[model samples]
Target chain A: MTLPLLQVRDLKVHFQVRAGGIFFANYLPLKAVDGLSFDLAAGETLGIVGESGCGKSTLGRAILQLLPATSGSVAWLGKDLTALDRAELKAHRRHMQIVFQDPLASLDPRMTAGDIIAEPLRNYETGLSSAAIKARVREMMEQVGLLPSMVNRYPHEFSGGQCQRIGIARAMILKPKLVVCDEPVSALDVSIRAQVINLLMDFQRALNISMLFISHDLSVVRHISRRVMVLYLGKVMELADRDAIYGAPRHPYTQALISAVPIPDPEKERAKPRVLVAGDLPSPLDPPSGCVFRTRCPKATNICALTVPVLESAGVGHEVACHHWRD
Target chain B: MSASVLDLKNLSVRFATPEGEVAAVSELSLSVGKGECLGIVGESGSGKSQTFLAAMGLLARNGRAVGEAIFGGINLAAADENTLNRLRGNKLAMIFQDPMTSLTPHMKVGHQLTEVLVRHRNLKFPAARDRAIAMLRRVQISEPERRFEMYPHELSGGLRQRVMIAMALMCGPELIIADEPTTALDVTVQAQILDLIRRAKEELGTAVILITHDLGVVAGMADRVGVMYAGRIVELGEVHQIFNAPQHPYTKGLLACTPRLDDATASALVTIPGQPPDLQQLPTGCAYHPRCGNVMERCRAAAPPLMSTGGGGLKACFLENFGSVQAGTVVP
Candidate 1:
């Protein structure tokens, strides 16, 4: 069997946050990502979904090495990324790229669309001639539905949808093996979101690239990803195939999260039974013992507070970390 | 319908920007009934928010509103600042997207809620404080007595929104305009807040104008639905009619694009071809014709007015059968 394209094990990212003021300052470790493990095969999309402050974004950043992991290993193509030196990591960065949530903020304001798309190529592929880079930029622009005539236009001149198209062009210009899409369509208007989403899927099909899509929007994540992972308070609650997770989510938190999403059908939405989880997410600084989600979880028991549950396979391609999961 | 609480006629809002005058809202005529919820759904630059902003006299310095917004038998559109000041928070309340900015960070939440009652309802300090605590409890914020003394920063986002709702209800306004009230919240919290809004409507009988881009949100709450595009109401009908039999092509396109959680099919989402129109330089004819699926020659030559479609709804389209074909079924 070919080794999985990317493998992550026991990933943890902790930040030392300073608490209190002046003379009575104390340092507290905030575990942004605690013990997350997953594997992504080539041409697959793994979606990470959670509510605010649930550490989905932190996990994405750790995998990219944008932020240092306090422990655990991320192996890319048989090489452990955590142990890599600066020179080695720099060379490996060519195979990975990221697309941020805010398209306008992520792209450079001063740089024209042409130059923005060419910047990545110029950095990674120094051997390529300027003419070759320009040609590739033009081709990428066309692929993302941007006219070559608009290549010289600044981001400000383009609409939000156009700017996102430009952002996609830049991200795909390098032809990277993996791309981390961090809520790419969340900032866009409703009508324009589908356009950008389809553009991403089209690129995935053509390039056969792997993707780690991190989003709070459950519907979008389900639409794009093959597998979905649920996170709460820096811990994985459930991970399963897209259909299995959406159709038969095992963890209580996952069930509540999925049911809470408002469906478009009025008759169905009005009639559907909602599993409304009580209260907001507890602060990550003082997460509940055992199960991180027990504080707000509806099915909290003494055993849940005493003993932490570990991730175990319940079925084929379905894993959950809850002692009381029925399915 | 129940006695009209707020009636608007031919309302238009324009802003004098460097790129010339932008008509944000053009000739909008609508009314909200007592104890009814009117949802205005649109994408960015479709002028959903600007319509309510104009009605509230909250437009920017460069912005000007013309025409009439008849609230409680008074012409709010032509009302002076002094007249609007009396009715702004007392008779008509507005809830914004960000609760933190809408709230006063310096003042305790109890003081904030009591101040509205004292100013609008002319209640004594002690009585106002008691009523404010009751309002907080009504919004389901536990420990209202203790929470009353807490500042806005002390409460979580969901709690802050509850406080905002309490403040809005303090005056017992006849109409409440909530502009993306749950947009900043988590999904679970959003559900809670939306339930709170429904309770407010059911118990208090206060009319609501819910402005949001999420069709799912409108599906659950709205009684009457209005689809806006380029500062114009393209379709207006009952919520059920709008969802089940959307007449306008734009509305159909929007419904098609929104991925449904109930839908088990794994097909790619349907996308409208072009970007949302620029408010400054709208297309000559139909603002949506450029991106519309069933574009016709008449759609390019002339703008379609909001004509009664005989299907218990109004549709602005030149096509004979605008939404006869279901949208998003064929993803090209």
Candidate 2:
């Protein structure tokens, strides 16, 4: 049997946050990502959707080994990535890459767009001549729909959407096998956001690249991902195929979140009954015990607070981590 | 029919940047009826925000406005500083995207709200305090009395935004301009804030100008919608007409590009090719022709005027059958 392209198990990321008053300073572990496990096929897309403090971004970084995981196993092509040394991981870094949310901030201001795209090529392949690198950069820029003549322009000269295209070129110049897109289109304008989304989809199909897409927008995530995972307070609330997750979500939090999204159709918006979850999301620093989502879950019982529900399959290809999830 | 609460004619705003003079808004005209909500939707730098900012006399230092904004028998665009100071916040109120920046950090929420009432209504301290607390309770802020003493930083984001809304409505303004009021909020909190704004319109009968990029929010709140592109109103109509039968190609393309929640298994999202036009160096004729799918030879040579569709709407396009219900093709 063939191995999955990437496999993660029991992934946990914690940060030591300062707690208590100044006079009695003590450290508390902020469980950013308590436990997450998933697998990515060779050319599949897995989208992670959640709100601000849900740790979606942290999970993406942990997968790339950019941040050390407190405890987990990241198996890439049957090799354990978490156990690899610094030099060994550096050699494998070419196969993994990341695209940040803010295009201008992630890019170096001093370097021209062409130089920035070519920097990865030069760093990975030392034997390549300068002329070859320049040719490759120009080719990649053209593929991403950027004018080859505008390569010499600085990041400051381009608009937000154009800067995002340049960011895509930089990430794809090496032709990596996996790309972690962290809110790639959130910072762009509405019209320009569509352009970037289409461009990313085209690249994924043409190159057969696997992406771990992380975003807060549900519609955008559903548009690109084959499977989706909903996160709340750094725990997986539900995981299933895109259609299953959107059409028939099991967890109450997922139901409320999906209903909270205002649809563009006026007639339907007026007719549909809205499920509004009350109160703000509790701080991750002091997450509620047992089921982390119990504080906001409408169907919470006494048992929900007494026991932590484990992620289990509710139906074929659908897994929900709630004790009171009734189909 | 009653006269419009506010009328704008031939409004233009220009900014002097290092590159050159950029026309942020050009000869735009709009109006808000009594107890109506007008939503202005556009991408970044499309001048949706600048149009209202000019009417409110809130343009930046390097920006200049030339227009006639008749509000309550007075030209707000031509009003003096003293007149504007008296009218602003008393008759005309504005809500910003970030509530924290608008509210003073050092002052208590109660004091900030009371200052508006004291200055506008000439109310005593005790009376103004009572009014401020009442407004807070009206906006559905729980523990209104206790929250009244809390500083701006002490409140959560949703509470801070509610406080901002309460502060804006303290003097019972006739017109309130909310610019992306819910953009910085989460989905659930965004719903709550929109509900508050709707209640304000229904109960208080105040006209509102809502500026945002989210079509979903516009569909829920706006009675009328205006689509802007390259510093011009490409299309304007009732919210139902704009959503069901968009006229301008730019408006249609924008609708198609957005991923709709109702589209359960949509395989691909439509996209408008090419970049948004730069205001400083906009192409001649129809500004959207370069990226428009239904572009023709005439569109590249001559500009199209805002022609009335005679259905309580307007469209600026060369196509004769612009407002047809069928979706237009997207030219690559």
Query: Which candidate number has the best TM-score?
Result: 1
How close is chain B to the truth by TM-score, in each candidate?
0.97, 0.96
- Predicted complexes: DockQ each: 0.75, 0.64
Q: Write the per-residue lDDT of candidate 2 for residues A1-327, one digit (tens) a residue.
A: 789989999999999999876888799999999889988998889989998889999999999999999998889998989999999998989888888999899889999999989988988988999889989999999988889999899999988888889999999988899999999999988778877888888888888999999998998898899899999988999999998899999989888888888788778776778777777788888888899989878899998899999999989889999998973
Q: Candidate 2: lDDT of B64?
A: 90
Native contacts recovered, each model: 0.67, 0.56
User: How much lDDT does each candidate structure score?
Assistant: 0.89, 0.88
Best by lDDT: 1
Q: Which stretches of candidate 2 lie over 4 Å from their true place?
A: B323-332
What is the Cα-based lDDT of residue B199 in candidate 1?
88
Give the range of the ten consecutive residues with the poorest summed lDDT in model 2 chain A. A270-279
